[model samples]
Target: MSVDVITFGLNHTSAPLAVREQVSLAGELMKPALTALRSAFGGAVREAAILSTCNRTEIYCAAEPSAARELPAWLADFQRVEADALQPHLYRHSQDEAVRHAFRVASGLDSMVLGEPQILGQMKDAVRTAEDAGALGTLLHQLFQRTFAVAKEVRSTTAIGEQSVSMAAAAVKLAQRVFGDLRQVKVLFIGAGEMIDLCATHFAAQHPARMTVANRTIARAEGLAGKISAGTMRLAELPEHLAEYDVVVSCTASALPILGLGMVERATRQRRRKPIVMVDLAVPRDIEAEVARLDDVYLYCVDDLGRLIQTATDARKAAVVQAEAIIETRVQHFMHWLGTRRVVPVIRDLHEAAGAMRAAELERARRALARGDDPEAVLEQLAHGLTQKYLHGPLAALNQSEGEHRDQLLTWLPKLYPLRER
Candidate 1:
């Protein structure tokens, strides 16, 4: 089978938030999803990893050709959606295409914000998770190692990361507009996922009066809170503590809103008309839209941050051009490597055939020697037999060819079988 180290998935470019969220895999579910993917495809899938971020959900696998063909069906089954429904949003890449996609992704070329640096770290985390799940293999390991190298080269050689506005930084900017100075504000974060963690980091750096994390699981909340030396609270406690914080930022995968209009109204009353800034970075939204109507509460959604970040597009365009050039050069280099891999089987076959011919000739010489033939004659015959056998096919083909074909073979033969004259 012509197995390919391949990748398939949907990203922000291909799918809407509604569809992306439906198929998104939680970090905790990654291991089970990988195991299920392997089981569904059997031996065709040798190794597999799933990277599910808010912006993308990709499956990377070392699988046979048949398995690559069958991956869409497996994804449909895993997500419990119709194959046709998922197929429209999906993109597939094999061998070099796969390698190029991975490199671009790690280098941030494929990000929603082109040339963002966060993706490289996210990709590293994906690799670590894959290794922990025993999903990494020779093919993926080599691919990732090279991927990281390419990312590093792209960053160092190009201005890709210059003038970049991170989501965390955007959050801070949005909060600043509402609350004036974050230093005097208490910021509360809902959920301890990567987004919340990042938001916490940026806001904490502003030296907010206090930072608090509220998670469905208090342990997770405490874990993230401890990292930033922030306070922790249970999700249930958010209703009570809502009024205490001046700024509230939330990003969670909860199917429903965690913060409602009533809670915010209550919090606003408790704060006695003081302005409360809120940013809901989640798709479904952790804070309700109705809360935005409150007089003293200023609420911003993901789209708002997206709009704010868009202002930097013109400023960063020149850097993006430089980054794309770097990515293109790396892509060409990777494609050359992939092309070399394709001829490996032919090279192996040639080596095996030559070895067999040598063995056959050595046996013949041994038999002749045992029969008491002259040692010099036996050795001469062995060398002649081996040379003739090796050259027979090519010689016969070259002799029979005519016109341009003959000329082409004649030119190629000299290079293939060079002779040194004494």
Candidate 2:
């Protein structure tokens, strides 16, 4: 069977954060994860790219159809999660569905926060990583190039992203509800990644009393802090300073929780029952779930933020309709292009066969002329030879085939050799 385009994985809609984090492949682990994906299928998966972000973990592959069935198990094994547990949350899209999924994702139609722009950059980073790992091939490269084009077209032509209620905005909104006045609150961002940066920008606009960024690397933390004109601190300093902030926003690539119940308990004790609004944006969760139970702490996770932005504006709803229509048309065009690829090998073989026939006929004509045969006769014979050779296969098929097969060939013959007006 021919290779197929396959996309299989889970996203925010299909799975909760717990399952998503289990299967998530961080940036540094992408190449190794891709290698394991290919190896798992014993070469059935030819070309693959793994896109692992906080909201989703998708594996886009050029693979035999049979391989797609095993992908869930491969993911379960790779992540060391039980197949039975992971299988329920997984979704598989093949051929056109797969292409459409990629386009919708890049276009932000499928994000937690509708029309948010960060996913596009994250997708581009995933593609770059795949390319660097040598996992990308012509089919995926073409798909992504078109995906980017379609995303740009949708964003430019439609108001899908207009008046967007981004996750960052949602986080800020939640903080305002909890603390009532952001101007009086001190905010601390717990990561230097894109999500954290976005959250920092949103919170800064409120002109909070103070802002600070903390990361594993002080340099990265300092970089973001400088942009927002906030203070910087190392990850190690978080425990000592956690009590100082009235609101905490965290998103990081950490596989485990950074802030545990014990740490939050200590912070709360120091704050003397002063309410602190905490937003944990990471997949594995930067703040421990148990921390939510604290009396002095109001905790929120990504899912909580997602709920706030679920309802779209009327204008955005209209834009979504337009965007989907555009995407559907583009999907059909891509599928048509993919269909043409199925005949590529056949076309090449036809060219090779025709070349062989021409070479054989020319050589025969040359030998005939060398042996003193009439040049005009040799030329006629060569032309006749070429025509007969070209017609041989079709003629044989027509003579041997019966009923529907013969009828199909007859219909194709006219298309293959259309009559020219003379």
Candidate 3:
């Protein structure tokens, strides 16, 4: 069966944070999700890759058409979210649209913060995870490779990322809005990952009263802390000292939410209603959704930060136009590749049939030669046999068809045949 390129899911544009979070999967959950896609549809699905970030949860697949239709439902089931609830926010694309979407996404054209480079890195991680899960096949593998190429082209050729406000920078910007001066407020960053490092760098520049780095790995946290002249603590100790900091930024790879409603609630009670600004940049989310409702807490998720970063996007709008044009051309090229792939089976079948005719004719010629027939006559018979067999199918179709069917055959037959003077 010829596989179709298909992608379906919700992004920040189509769904709210509540909807996106319900569908987000990462780390240990990814392998099982990829496995679920294959098992849920049996052999109908050939290859699959899931890209679940804070702003979007998209599943890309090389699948049979019918199997592609089942993806949204399969996704909702795996995430334990209702299919109906998910379907309204979900958008499915196949063939050219799938290629276009992948290109647009990797190039950061479709991101919540357009042209932000973080998505490219996230895409790389998703690809690696899919490969590890044995879910990547020829179609998806090529799609991603081209997607990366297109992204690099966009970044190098256009100024899409120029003057962009990064998520880390947006976090600081939001925090500064709430707390007038970072110099007076204490900042605590959770996780020692790149995001945490970026956030620490941005916040450290403002020179907070005290900075703290907490990670599951104390050594990693210490390394980050020592550079910023900040203190280091175990991630376990965050809950105890949570209320002490005025600004809390958390981005961790923990499967489950590290900071829950109850934990933040207690922290808020300790602060006596002093507002706490928290940025949760993790995909599955380092902070709980319910915690956002707390009166004294300012909770900003990735999408929320994305919205804040939009003010500066005006400068990069020109680059977006340039990037989109590049993407359109690439999408057409990719679709052409897919179009050729559809004829591959037919081409193979023709080759096989032709080979069979050659073998049969050559064998007959060998027998005739053994019977003392002339070499030139045997060669002539062999040539006639091969020619007749090759023309039989097309000749039969052309003669049997009527009106438009015959006309269609007349138009296509020459293209199918090697009829040109060679």
Which candidate wins on lDDT? 2
- How does candidate 1 fare on TM-score? 0.82
**Scored by CA lDDT, what does every candidate get?**
0.83, 0.91, 0.89
Candidate 2 residue lDDT tens string, 212-231 = 99999999999999999999
Superposition error at 330 for model 2 (Å): 1.5
The better-scoring model by lDDT among 2 and 3 is 2
Instruction: Predict model 1's lDDT versus the native.
Output: 0.83
**Candidate 2, backbone clash total:** 0
Model 3, span 1-422: residue lDDT tens: 66789998889999987788788886678999899889989889999998988788899999999997778878877888888888899999999998999999999888877788888998999999999999998889989999999999999999998887788889999999999888999999999988889889999999999999999989999989988999999988988999999999998877679999999999999999999999999877889888889998999888889788776455588898999999999999988887887888899997998888889999999999999999999999988998898889999999899999999998898788878755
For candidate 2, the 10 contiguous residues with the lowest summed lDDT are 413-422
Error of 3 at 232 (Å): 1.5
Superior candidate under lDDT, 1 versus 3:
3
By TM-score, the candidates rank as 2, 3, 1
Off by over 4 Å in 1: 64-66, 181-185, 205-210, 216-230, 243-246, 252-277, 282-304, 313-315, 395-414, 419-422
Itemize residue pairs with steric clashes in candidate 3. Answer: none
Q: Residue by residue across 1-422, what tens digits does model 1's lDDT show?
A: 65587999998778776677668786677888887887887788888877777678898888998788888888888878788988899999987788778988998878776677777887888888889988888778877888899899878877777777778888899888877777889989998988888888888889988988988898999999998989888888887788999888899988678999998899999999999889887765678888889998889876567557654465466766776677677778776775687689899999999999989999999999999999999999998998899889998998899999999997788788875744
